[model samples]
Target chain A: MTTRVLVAKVGLDGHDRGIKVVARILRDAGMEVVYTGLFQTPEMVAVAAIQEDVDVVGLSMLSGAHLTLAPLVVAALRERGSDIPVVVGGIVPGNDVEDLTAAGVAAIFGPGASAEEIVTAITTLVPQGH
Target chain B: MTDNPYKTWREAFDAAPTRDADFTTLSGIPLEPVYGPEEGEFPGAYPYTRGIHASMYRSKLWTMRMFAGFGTAVDTNARFREIIAAGGTGLSTAFDMPTLLGLDSDDPMSLGEVGRCGVAIDSLADVRDLFAGIDLSRITTSMTINSPAAVMLALFVAQAEERGVKRSALGGTLQNDILKEYQAQKEFVFPPRQSMRLVRDTMAFTAAEMPKWNSISVSGYHIREAGSTAAEELAFTLANGFAYVELAREAGLTIDDVAPRLSFFFNAHIDFFEEIAKYRAARRVWATWTRGHYGAEDPRSWQLRFHTQTAGVSLTAQQPEVNIARTAIEALAGVLGGTQSLHTNSMDEAIALPTARAARIALRTQQVLAYETNVAHVADPLGGSWFVEELTSEVERQAEEILAEILDKGRGSMLEGCIAGIEENWFQGRIADSAYALEKTFNAGRRIVVGVNAFTEGNEEEDLAILRITNADEKKQVERLAAVRQARHAARVEAALATLKRQAADPTINLMPALIDAAKAEATVGEMMGAMVTVFGRHVEVPSL
Candidate 1:
């Protein structure tokens, strides 16, 4: 069994350092990783996820647009009837992590999160062989 | 009574080298148990493992270049004056996305983006307005622009000439590094090879005329901020720089002629000492390579002068105020590491473009360090410090290895290979692995960042107003852009663009003169870019693993 994660950078946040890093780590860890490049609209992110048929949708947001951008991606995924677990990482404030989680983000990794921990979280959330 | 305390300490320290090893690098470079002269020789020498100059900051203070740009030319001009009055010795211009991408404000694609991130300069008129009272002859300026950098530079030259300032007298830099734009920053107009051509042309032009001006600021700021590690940033940036030198030489210019004017821009990230070591290692590596590999004779050409901006990614949207502290530390690292110019991130940067007050505070932070602190009193104050020297050597080694890997892929035509590596998430993979590992440490209570995972705090409202660029400004910009298009002679514009397209097709003809001619005929950025697109074609990034 394999865990598939779609790592997408939504909106105008050109900062992909985190997302790219996570994608590489997941791929190396034997999880399939799909990376959608910069300026990905929410619709684009969801469509890519569905097309790729990934188990987790990881959104990396650095532009303060996360408040507006992250939720839109989650909502778009839901509207598409996709229940794939979602995770987000970037300069997300601690207080907003819970709000993001409540908005259907399964987990949130802020600055300083380890790739292993994120990989572990994704595995736990959608356990391999489940 | 004498239980051999040293032996006991060694036993405890060596208990678990694998799990409990206390290391001091993002890549986990092990710390030496101790350091002697044998570890690293000294400062002001080969490998420059300590400091480049014998007396570093003590001899000259780092240039306080506050990055300023906002709204229209008039608005940005005001900000520039305010910053200079408040002790900014150098000027750094930040153009709006449209300007950066070579679109006039009135273009359809530039509707809402003009003057939002930076200033909007549609023509030489706006450029004149931008530097209205400023003395270009006396003070230096750095333009944070790429893509259509050649046009912007031509406007700058024409504007200076209009004010009776000679091109030779112009002392500044243009972020003419278009390669990095394709690599990290998305604001690119022409394809990679053509962009390199423009850079070479500009280098050729500047080498002949504006000798004091830096033709290219090979930037790793965007790359590092985009998620590269300190070593990746240093290595990739130097590789890009070497590629440019090779390109310039291919264009019939000698290495020594252009190397001196070449500069760099780095992102001073949150890792305090790591950032410092990166800078130190950069200088040594650049000096060694230019002198040894490129056969650069000029000492100035060997020196790696750079500008730095505090890592924008390090700032948090949650506890916005905490960003101030982070910026301060980053700025300190940059200053200590010997940056020629520095821009501290505004506290509210994580939210939006900085307001007037926030920009002031950011400038004042540099001022406080310059005048108020004793950090500037000594040159390379940390020079020969056992830890700093070791870290510097480690970074240099790592960076050199990365550069070798890049060079081995292909030196001159590595753009495709580089992009392929990126698509395969090679660089991104390394950065993510390090970033995640660091985060894991913090989460596991092994590492701690104040006001983050370890520090729980109540909700606190920010006292400052986050400046937002309104849609009305965008509308005005569009209207202004439209008016300019309406006023300019359509026939002349079309003729100039056709001429530009013709010149662009020929490799021998320098594109700068034609680009300037196009700009003079009121050719909008989009039109010029469109013409080039017809000739050069758009770059379709290759999809990889």
Candidate 2:
């Protein structure tokens, strides 16, 4: 069974270069991909993730709001009683990784994350629950 | 008679005040300043394939403009003073995401983004705080705002007027090119046709009133960063510019009046030769169109002046310090390409906002290139090189091809076609396809990005201490926004916005005066933009991946 993933830009940053590439990466790896468009608030993203019923949700935040916005996204998912794990990507500093992890973000991908690494992380996080 | 270019150059070389610098290679081998080219194709001549100016950087080095902004107006103001105090001639402002989107700091849509990406500005008070100590008359500013650019520029002029600076005394460039926002950047607010009206309004006002101002800096920088190829960036930007030229004619503005005040902004991407060729191709294409298509008589109308910024997408988070080397190479490419101004990317930008140390290094990169390197001593130094000439011509051909497609899409009207293309996702789909193709090659190990795919031994990202804006700053900005609302007279703001709304609905009225009135009444950027939005319903792009 193929895993499914939802990639979303969760804040005001309009930069979708990496996430677009990630969508193709997962698609080529035989995983289903859903890309929610830009400027999504946490609630909108959570609603989309739950409605889409994806195995994992990936949020791209390049506008340095990841520290403040990513955790809200995690809590937003929990608030709606969805345990779909979330991964935060883009320009995340090393020092903030612990806080993001503590906030229940499952994984973090920075600028240079490879396609194989991203696919592996997604597959491992969502375990064989197609 | 069309004389041979070499002989013409020879006669002019002897008659003109003999060039003052030593024309020699590093080993002191005597060398000619520049090789010959066609009479009509030389620098400062028709179609300006070489450069818009004859001397190029020999007389004036490209303005070393550094883009800096973060946190609040106070925070960005300190940085501006430092840039000007440190011998930097120009200041390029980077507004925070909320400000860029025309939201007040307290707007719910602006949560956590108030000061995250750049400075948080809500009112004319914020603008006053932004330029507190800096003399507005002396320093030139370039604002990177689009959707709300008219409001931002109005606020700026109001601030200058409060300081007793005449409107004519101001100098700056407004990134009023709304076409690219729909095509790439995705920061658009109104429908493309309505947005073009706002852009045209600014052009009409600035072309008449503010002689020193550049009304529309039709930009390809964001398009390139959003994954466009070099030729695509050039073609799309020039296409948007031509759309404005046509739109201006519709508004009763002449080509010569608006064209001279129009400028361009481009990206100096990682590919060295390709980036240089893109700039050369850009000048040729712009000059040819402005003359043949627009029927402009002023020579200034034919010259394409531009500012170049090193590509931010090329910077990597792994081994972040290596970006310094990359920025230097890209900056050198911009200089060689004859840019009118430049902004070099800071090394640590890929990881976070650039730390002060990282920003200093970026500025020093330009200083070294401008002063230490002798690349600027001669104009179009590579003019006659076979490889460069061929690449330049090829890039020109490719860009013209792309422009033709866009023109056909509009059915001969670029403005209409761009709006059609946006609705059809033509630009977004093409960019995504190109980006995916490159990603496929990298994933297949066919293309190597150092420190990522190759040279991975002992590679570690050094702790460059990236700049981070805290939520505390957000709270502070919100409080300031609250205070501003409480202080300003509600009646004044309401009346001003009422006028703006009425004028926005009537296409005949130039909205600049009304916008300036609203700003003078201390109306927040959001309220002013909201008024216009009500008149012109909001626009949302169709989702594309």
Candidate 3:
């Protein structure tokens, strides 16, 4: 099965180099990837995730707005009654990791995360039934 | 063993196996094992391949201009004071996203984003607060803003006037480069033609009125950050600069008139020798093109002055302390390459806005490089090296090819051609391809990043203190913006914006005067930009299929 993932950048952060790199990495891994480009609102990301029926959501944020923005994506998913596992990456402070996980994020990938680690985490975190 | 004296050493050297890897640079320039004397004469001469100045750092050290701004204007002002106290020579301002996009801190779209990435400057009030105690006459201030750069420059000029300083006496660089915004940074607002008009207005205004200020700093920093090769960065930045010169000429100024004030900004990535070569090549290419192609007569017009920032993209959030070494090396490359000024990225920048302590350490890296390392004693110390010469010429040749391609795309004008390229997504496509290729190589384990691919460390966050901006900061900024709106007379702002809109519609009239009037009237960034948006529609990039 081709693992479907939606790589998203939410809020007003214009740094897209990291997110673009992640999208290409996922695509190279033989996964179906849809990128919801820069300045995407939570509503936009959630709608895209549902429409694409992605198995995992990889959110890339660097403006220290992950705590505010990441939870919105998770909550929007909950509002839609979707169980797509969300993985957050990019400059997530270590102290906030446990909180984000507690808030229903499946995994957190920081600056030095390898492609294998990221791909493996995404593959394992997604439910087999999906 | 053989009887010959060198037989054993030669045999041993041949027996040892070397790693089978490509010896080319990121731009695909081939490298040799050693370098000796070759082409190119002494530094500080015509066609300045080695450097633009004779003394280089020996006579005057490069300006240590640290890019620091976050939270509200007052907060950033305090940071500026701290930077000056800690021995920084100049200041570079980084505006927040909303401000960069020409939106007020109180705009609905600016919620939760106020003062997050950089300082939020809504009106002249914020700009005034930004430089409260700093003497504008004494220190050079470089602002990193595009799209709404004219508006920001107007605000800065207004601040200087308010402090009883002559506009002619004010000195600094305004990153009025909009072409790069369209191509890489993605901070563009109005359509291309309209945006260039704004850029034209600033160039003409500064060249005539503010002779001491650099009207624009043509930047390749963002292009490199967007994953361009060194050659691409050089070629794209120089091409954009050529377009600006052409635009100024069309606007009725001679090339020499505007060209002298023109400057450049580049990214110093971790590739030490290659980075140095890139800068050297950049100067040679710019000098040749401006002199031969543009017919620039003034020596200053032919010289390429640039500022180099240590690559922010190269920093790693994991084992972030090691980034100090990375910055030091990159800064050294910038110095050796003869940068007029430099900014060293803090180790923690990859994670969050640089903490005050982290920023100080970053500044000190430059201090050590400038004062301690005697490498700055000579200009282009590697000028005659065979390897560096090959790399420099190759970089210049590749950049020339790209420039020719861009010029051909424009028909006759590089400016027209670049606008065409932007519309056709030529620049974006090339950058995307380069970025994707680099990322693929990193993923395939062909390239090993110390903390990333190899010697992987788990979380070392326990010891690090990342700068945290709270929600309270956003609330406070919005409140400040609200108060400014209340205090200013609404009629004055409305009248000034009307004049601005009227001038925006009439392309012949310069918008700086009208914009400065708006700034004086206390018009917010969003309001003034909104008025212009009425005449010149906003730009919404059509994503590639």
**By lDDT, who's the top model here?**
2
lDDT of each: 0.76, 0.87, 0.87
For residues B1-545, what per-residue lDDT tens digits would candidate 1 score against the true structure? Answer: 12453343334334423322233333555444322343343344444544554444544567888887878888889988888887778899988867776777776545446676788888766888899999776668999888888888888887887788888888999999987776677676666777778888999999998888999999999878666678889998998888888888888988898898899999999999999999989999998888888888877778888899999877765567788889999999998887878999898776567888888888888877876665654445566677987998899999989887776667434444454455455654555566556545665678666655556473255435776665677677677777888899999989999999999899898888887787777777677877888898866444232
- How accurate locally is residue B168 in candidate 1, as Cα lDDT from 0 to 100? 88
Which digits, one per residue and each the tens of the lDDT, describe model 3 over residues B336-408? 8999999999989887899899999999999988766566655687877889889999998899999999999
TM value for model 1: 0.80
**Candidate 2, which segments miss by more than 4 Å at Cα?**
B1-33, B37-40
lDDT of 3: 0.87
Question: DockQ score for model 1, please?
Answer: 0.16
Which runs in model 1 stand beyond 4 Å of their true positions?
Answer: A1-13, A18-34, A39-130, B1-55, B106-108, B411-429, B432-445, B543-545
Please provide, for model 2 over B1-545, each residue's C-alpha lDDT reduced to its tens digit, 9 standing for 90 to 100. Answer: 13665555445444455445665656787755455745435666667877887656655678998999999999999988878877788898899998888888999889888888899999999999998998756778999899999999899989989989888878999988898888888888888888888898899988878999999899999999888888899998999898898899999989898999999999999999888888998998998888987788998999999999999998877787789999999999898899999999998898877877788889999998877777877778777778888999999999999988999998998877787888899988888888888888888899888888998764663566778899899999999989999999999999999999999989988999999999999999999989999999888776778
What global local distance difference test value does model 2 have?
A: 0.87
| Candidate numbers, best DockQ first, in rank order | 2, 3, 1
Candidate 1 scores a C-alpha RMSD against the true structure in Å of 10.4
> Candidate 2, B85: how far from true, in Å?
2.2
